[model samples]
Each structure stands twice: as structure tokens, then as C-alpha cells.
Target: MEWLETRELRYFTAVAEELHFGRAAERLGMAQPPLSRAVQRLERRLGVALLDRGRHGVALTPAGAVLLDEARATLDAAAAAARRTRRAVEPGGRLVLAVKANGAHDLLRALLDAYAREPDAAEVEVVLCGIGEDERMLRDGRADAALLHPLYSSLAGFDSEEVLTEEQVVVLPAGHPLAARTSLTLAEVADVPGLPAARWPLRDGGYPPGPGPEVRDLSQLAQLIALGRTSTVIPASARAWLWTAHSAVPLVDAPSVTTHIAWPPQSRSRPLAALVRTAVGLGRQA
Candidate 1:
């Protein structure tokens, strides 16, 4: 009894209840031989006949039935103890959050608020990751989790949730001819005097800079747009956060941006899990 592990109890209970070694192993996610060995070990330690073997089925003896009941209670108690320890560590634990520019919205803001207010989880670690490198960082465990586009959903070994959905807005140059118009369409900007529909340093595609201008980042793109460079199209939230001093109009006929929280399935960090819990809260809030 002292030397028998809880796993042995679990294995015995599974076989006792199922009355079948193969089915018990399948449920326990282990090979049949290993499960049979565990049951044999348990019976040996207790010095009792636990199961009556049969060609077509297995049945627990009376002693096995009593042991099965006790085993389940012991495992439940063990599980509760584990949860308490996890909660203790959750307080002020570290979390590595990976995010792209697209997911910076009210939902993310709310998630921050939740984490900041959680009782067992208030401390956090945030990382700014780009969409281009999102999958690698998550799959390789370089980052705990990330905010990504819908495309990242295709990446295996990870889970995701749509936390935010913001519509696209038309970012126009200040004092531009089309800026006076209430709204514009994609077809209207297709041949408009700027760069192609999509360009670097200009994610929103609302207002971009010169084609050869070497717009290294959004900061430069915004500066150029302020100086009446090419226009860009950006999500509405980005418009509020980054469209300062720039003329912005909603797209008359463009689709909205769907923001999702993506994370590797294998990570077991408590704080990282808290962030995901916060993401679920955000999803509910959405």
C-alpha cells in the first residue's frame, strides 16, 4: 500500500470498472501490456485476487471492487492538491505573450485589464511578435502565446480563439482629394496615384508612402502619409491608435479584420494559461 503509486491505483480502477484490459488502456492512453502489468503489481502488493480473467472479458473480484472505490477517491484528492499548488504559483507568475499588430484592440485591452485584476495572476510578461514569425515562435515555444490573423489558425500543435473583430478603415492623406469624400471603395483606390494595393511599412493600406521611399516601418509610413504620401488601409482600431494627425475614413466596401489569440497546445505555464483564460473572457465579452 505504501509503495503503490496512485497511477497503479488508477490503472487497477480502470480495468476493474471496464472489465477489459484493452478498453482500459485505450482510455488511459497507454499500451495494454503496461496496464496489465500495473494491475498485476497492484494485486501483488495488496495480496488479493483483484480480477478474474476471461477470454472474452475481464471481471473484478469483490476485493477489486472495494479497492476501485477507494482509488477513485484518492485520485480526486490528489488532483485537488495539485490544483491548489498550481494556484499558489499562479500568483505573480511569469507569462510570455506574443502578439502581432493586428490584435491590438479593445479585446486585447480588456485581456490586459483582466490579467491586471486577476487575484492569483497579476504579473505578466508581454512580447511584441510579428505575424510573419508567429507560428515559429509559438511552435518552438519561444513565446507562450500570440495575437495573430486567421491564417495562423492553420498552424498545427496550437489552439486559437477569435477575440476581436474590427472593420477596415480607409486611411487617406490629409487634404487629399478623396479625403473630403465621406467614404471610398477598394476599386476606387486600385489605380489611385499611389503604390500598389498592398505595400510595405503600410499595413492598413489606408495611406502608404512612395514606392522607392524605403518605408522601413509604420512610424515612417505614418510620417509619409502625414506629408501626403500614399494612402493606406488599416483596421479601425489601428486608426484610433496610429492615425493621429491623419485623415481617416471607413472603407465603403471592404471586409473587417478578425483578431484571434493563438497559442501552442503543449505549453503548461500557469501565467500563460491565465492569459488564455483572459482571452476566453475577452471572447465572451466580444
Candidate 2:
């Protein structure tokens, strides 16, 4: 078998994603016949049937499902390579760091300050992302690095350095009965009557099954907690974002959340390395 070229990979990816040659070709700005031929040739070369064409439209075989993931990764890698190459030639290219707007505020500030003092450190641009958007930003080359919490974010394909590890806490309304407690067990906090656990949206834009109010950000969660509509477990450091109406109690049995400076494995930028080193040193001092 011959090595697959980028063009063929792109064509196959479009078809695999759309599962219809006509739609895929339209999206790719090409005619349908050539797109169909290109896919057929790729299958022939790989000696595998990637898709099943039927009257009901098209479906991916097991092999197609596997290849779709691989092809997307390959395209992301190629795009990153192009972006990095261009940035390398440009003078004073800034490093973009993605982070949740309401998380790790102290750690983020210290990391930036320390990195700024380093010799030849690059200017950092902070990209404040929503919950669960950090990994996608890193994978697609939108960011040079990210401050991520492993408990709430996926770290599947990145190289990361642990920055801070802390216990969890439950945030509740100050007027709630549980506010008087200095500390609470996970079971106690989770079973509070009339206070359901706040539901957060998953990466796929769907909320987990729950009766509580759906929250998209820390501000929303804090509001719901203040109104006595729901309660939530979060990293202990997130207490900084709570308002006066909110009270936090350490959850004794809750899992620890580790904050990490994560980046794609394929990133070879020097500025990103300097920032990661600075973050690790700060973590050590904490």
C-alpha cells in the first residue's frame, strides 16, 4: 500500500463526515463525481471498505469510524504545522493561553508574571474560554497552551505539567441550612433536600441528566446558588468567584482537582516551553 497524501485524506474526511458524496462535494467546492472516485481510490489503496453505500444513504463501517478519527487528527496536525511555521517567521509572535474565565485566577496571574520576568519571554495573550473548551482549543491549534482542571476537562492527547492540586468544596446559599457547617461530606452535600446538583453542559452541548438548573459558567452557577436553586461541587480555589450570598464548605470525600498547563504534543514552540517551566516552578512553591 502507498502512503496517503493530504488531498486524499481531506476528501475522505469530508465524505466520512457527511456520509453523502453530493453534500461533501458541495462543501469541498468540488463536483460529486470526482469526489466519489477519490474515495473509491482511497479505499482501493487501503484495501478496506470504509463506507457502506446503500439506498438509505451512507454509513460508516467499523474501519471508517476508526479512520475518521485518525484523519481529523492528521488534518489538525497539518494545520498546526502551517500555523506554527508562519508564526516562527513573524517577529514577536505572541503565545495564546486558553483558560476557563472563572478558574485558577491566582495561578494564572502568577504564571504570567513569572514568565514575563524571564529573559526573552514572549508576550502572552490570554484566551478566556468557557468550561470544557480548553482541550478543543489546544487540539485545533487555537492556543499554544491552556490551564486545565483534569477533573472537569479531558487531557487525552496533550502533554501537560501539573500546576496545582487542591481539594473540592461545595458552594451553597449563605441562607441555606448547610451554610453553618464548617465542612461537609460528599454524601451530605449531594443529598440536600430542595437543592439539586447544578447541571453543567458537556462538550457535546448536552446537559447531564439532573433536575437542577443548567449552568454554563461560574457566574450562572453562583447566581443559582445564591437564589437557593441549586448547589455544586468545584475546585477549592474557585471559591474566589463566589459572591457574598454564597457560602463554601470543604467536601471531605470529594476528589482532588489538579490544574495542569497542557498543550498539544506536536507543539514545539519555545515560548510555550518557557511558560510551562514557569508554571511548574510556581506549582512547586505552592
Candidate 3:
């Protein structure tokens, strides 16, 4: 069998995702005819019908569905390799660590400080990201490592060590009646009158079905809580950044969130290993 080109995989993936050759072509910034031909050639090369073109529209065949997944993974890996290669040759390459904004809490600072004390520690560049973004940054080589929460991030493709685990608290407006409580159960927090649980964006950028306002980041959610617009359950450590108008009460039944230091297994460099070791050491001390 002939080796597949990244270009072919890219074209096929676009078509598979859009399910319309014309749309895919537009997305690729090319004409429809060539894009259609490229997909056809790929189908022939693979000896499989990747798409079914019925009168309604294009749909993926069983083989196409499988190929789509494989193609996406292959393309991501290729892109990651290119990025890593470029960064490696640059003078004094630094390690980039991605963390969700306000997600890491205290562990991030402690880890950075501890790692800096190591011999010849590379300069660390920290990238603050939104929910569900750290994993993408790590997978695409935009980051050498990421601090991720298993509840909000996927750890399927990386090697990770749990650095911190803490229970959750319900953050509410300081003036709210519930805010006066010393502690509350999840059920009590969930049905607070006029204060719905804030809806967070899913990986696909859609909010879960809820009556509360959708929030993109911790800052937004914090502001909303202060204004009595919404409430949310978050890791206990997040209370450090709560607004003065906000109150955080321990949620007795809320699940604990575990923060993990994750990195692509194949791209683990010396600096990344040292950073991970430092994080693990901190976890043991906690």
C-alpha cells in the first residue's frame, strides 16, 4: 500500500466534517472541483468508499467514519510534530505549560517555585486557557504540559500524575440567604431560589441544559455569582479568588476535583520530566 499524505488526510477530514464538498472546499479556501477530486483519489487509494453522496447530501459510510477518526488523529500528530520540531531548533527553547485560568489554584505557584530551584531548569512559559482548552493545547504541541482537572478535561492520550485533590464548594452571592450557612449539601445548592447553577461550556462550546446564564471562564462565573445572577460548584481552593461580594460554602455531597499534571507521553523532554517530578513531590507533601 502507498503511504498516505498529510494533504490527502486533511482534505478528507474537511469533507468528512462538513459533509458537503462545496462547504469543505470553501473552508479549505479552494475551489470545489479540486477538493472533490482529491477526496475521490483518496477513496480510490484506500480502496474504500469513504462518503455516500445521495440526493439529500453527503454522509459518511462506516469506513468513512472510521477513517475520519484516524485522519483527525494523524493530522493532529503531524501538526504537533512540526510544531515541536520548529521549537526544538530555536535558541534556548522554553517549556510551555497550559493551565485553565483560575483552575490550578495554589498548586501552580508552588510547582513553578519548586521546579525553578532544580539545576538548569528551563524557563517556563505559562499559558492560561479556558475550559477544555488545555488538552487541545497539549495535544497540538502548543504546550509541553498542562494542569488539568479530570472532571473538566480528558486525560486519554497523556501521561499524568495527580497533584491535588480537594472537595467542592458552592459559591453564591454574599447577601444570599444560603451564603449564611456554614455548609450545604449538593441538593440544597442545586435548588436555591433565583440562583441557578451556572452553566459551563462543554468541549463542543455548547452549554449544558440549565436555566442559569452560560459562563466561559471563572472570572465571568465569579462576577455572575457576585451579582446574584448565578451560582456554581467549584474546587474548594478556588475560594482564594472569590469576589468580596461572593460567599463559598462547602458542598458536603459535591464530588472532589483532582488536578493532574499531564503531558503527551511521546513528547516528554528533560524539562517536562523535571516539572512533573516537582509537581508529584508537592502532591506528596500536601
Candidate 4:
């Protein structure tokens, strides 16, 4: 086994993530040749071929795939160490909380208000992230904690407290035939002519193949539903944002969404603990 340097791990991670030396080089603000050389050096030091290069372009070898995950963990730890050190030296530092901008509306409002009243609470800076971004934000030190729903967000690698749980609902245009229904089953909402359920982007940035419109955020989906172009199933709390032109029917068979206050397991920050405590207390009340 050989000792790996942070620089080499960083270089390898960039290439592996982009799967293109040119793009990775541009992202790292360096020349492509040097970036390629760095990756080659890392592979040689590890005594394994990392990337498979051919006419089709770069693909990670089995070793490269393993190294990618390990390298990301290394980089995230380094970033977290730096961030914590800075926060420790600074006075009156604020704790950042990440959440999907459209999700966790009610829970976030209550958590913020309650946390504000805590005598030991530090300033809470909310970071409105895109779907599936909260985990990265929490792991990489960009956020101290996140409000995430387990159904729609990955809660792996973090310690969490369940903050809210609610039934799911099918959101539809007000004039839709099923809008008058008191409750709906998954089968009942699966296929609707001209109102296909909106497809959300997967973690990989691509939408699943479907006839439905691809949507990136809640507002976009809401607009599409308003226009009678799409429908979607979401947590019941989202009903708070529906317009008069929109309607929601309880999805009796849909899985409940449990919103949790999640943070990196390695975190030992006092402000973060206070915020989590506040969220847990409020969750119990709910």
C-alpha cells in the first residue's frame, strides 16, 4: 500500500466525477495535460489502472470507482476540518441549515422560530438547496444540519431526529375530474390523460424516461399543475402553498414522508446541538 496525498486524491476525484479530463481540468483551473498526468501518477502509485481510456472517452475502472468514493470521503473530511477550525476561531459564528427550498416549509418555519428563542442558539443561516443537495451540504461542511424527508432524500451517513411525519397527497388542477374526490389511491392517480405525473430529476441529473414533463423544483411543478399540464404526489404539508386553481386529494396508500433533522455524525458543534434539540422538542409536540 502507498500513502496518498490530498492533492492526488483531489485530482483523481475531479476526473472521476466529470469522467472527462478536459472538463475536470477546466473546473480545477489547470491544463488538461497536467490533470491527466496527475491521474496517471495517482494510478501508478496505487499500482492499479484507474481510468479506462478509449475512443468513447474516459470511464472509471473498478479500482477507479472504489477510489472515487474514498477520495470524496477524504475531501469532505478535509473541508469539514477546515470549516470547523475557522468557526472555532471566529466569534459569534452562525450555524448553517440546509433544506430543499420547496420542501419542509412548515417544519422549517417552526424550527426557526423555536430555535430563535433558545438562550444558547447561535444565528441560524438557512441554505435553500436543490433536491438531493442537503446531504452533500451537510457532509462537506457547507451546512451544519439539514431538514430532509427520508422518502425523497438520502439520510445515510448522518445522525437524525424525526421532526415531522405526514400523509401524502395527490396535487391536481382544480378542474381535474378527480379533484372532487376526498381520497385517492396510487392506482387512481397513476395515469391521467394530458396530466401525467411530473417527473423529478434523479440524483444523477437525468429524468426517468416518461411522457410527463420534467420538473426541477416545487414552483415549476406547481406552475405545470396550474396549467393543467402535469400532476404530482407530494407530502400533505405542501397543500399550504396550493393556489385556488389547484386541489389536493389525500393519497390513502402513499407512504408517509418523515422529515428529520439530520447532521453529520462527526459534528460536535454546540449551536448545532441546540438547534437539533429545539427541532426534537417541537417534533414531539407535533
The order by descending lDDT is: 3, 4, 2, 1
Show where candidate 3 strays beyond 4 Å: 20-37, 54-57
Clashing pairs in 2: none
Give RMSD (Å) of candidate 3 vs. truth: 2.0
Residue runs of model 2 more than 4 Å from their true location after superposition: none
lDDT of residue 163 for candidate 2: 92
Q: Choose 2 or 3, whichever is better by TM-score.
A: 2
Query: What is the TM-score ranking, best to worst?
Result: 2, 3, 4, 1
Better of 1 and 4 by TM-score: 4
Stretches > 4 Å off in candidate 1: 1-92, 151-156, 194-198, 201-214
**Could you tell me which 10 consecutive residues in candidate 1 have the lowest summed lDDT?**
196-205
Per-residue CA lDDT of model 3 for 1-286, tens digit only, reads 5898999899999999999999999999999999999999988988999999999999999999999999999999989988887876666568889998877568888888999998757889999998888889999988889999989889998999999999988888999999999999988887778998888889877889978898887778888888899998888887778889999899888888999999888864777788899999999999
**Tens digits of per-residue lDDT for model 2 on 85-174?**
676666786888999877877888888899999876898889888878877777777788889987778889889989999998899999
lDDT digits (tens) for residues 117-153 of candidate 4 = 9887898889888778887788777788998887767
lDDT of 3: 0.89
Worst 10 residues of 4 by lDDT: 84-93
Q: Residue-wise lDDT of candidate 1 within 152-252, one digit each (tens)? A: 33444468777777777767776778777888888887567753333553333343553535544566667777777666777777764555557777786
Pairs of colliding residues, candidate 4: none
Q: Which residue pairs clash within candidate 3?
A: none
lDDT, candidate 2, residue 206? 93
Error of 2 at 42 (Å): 0.6
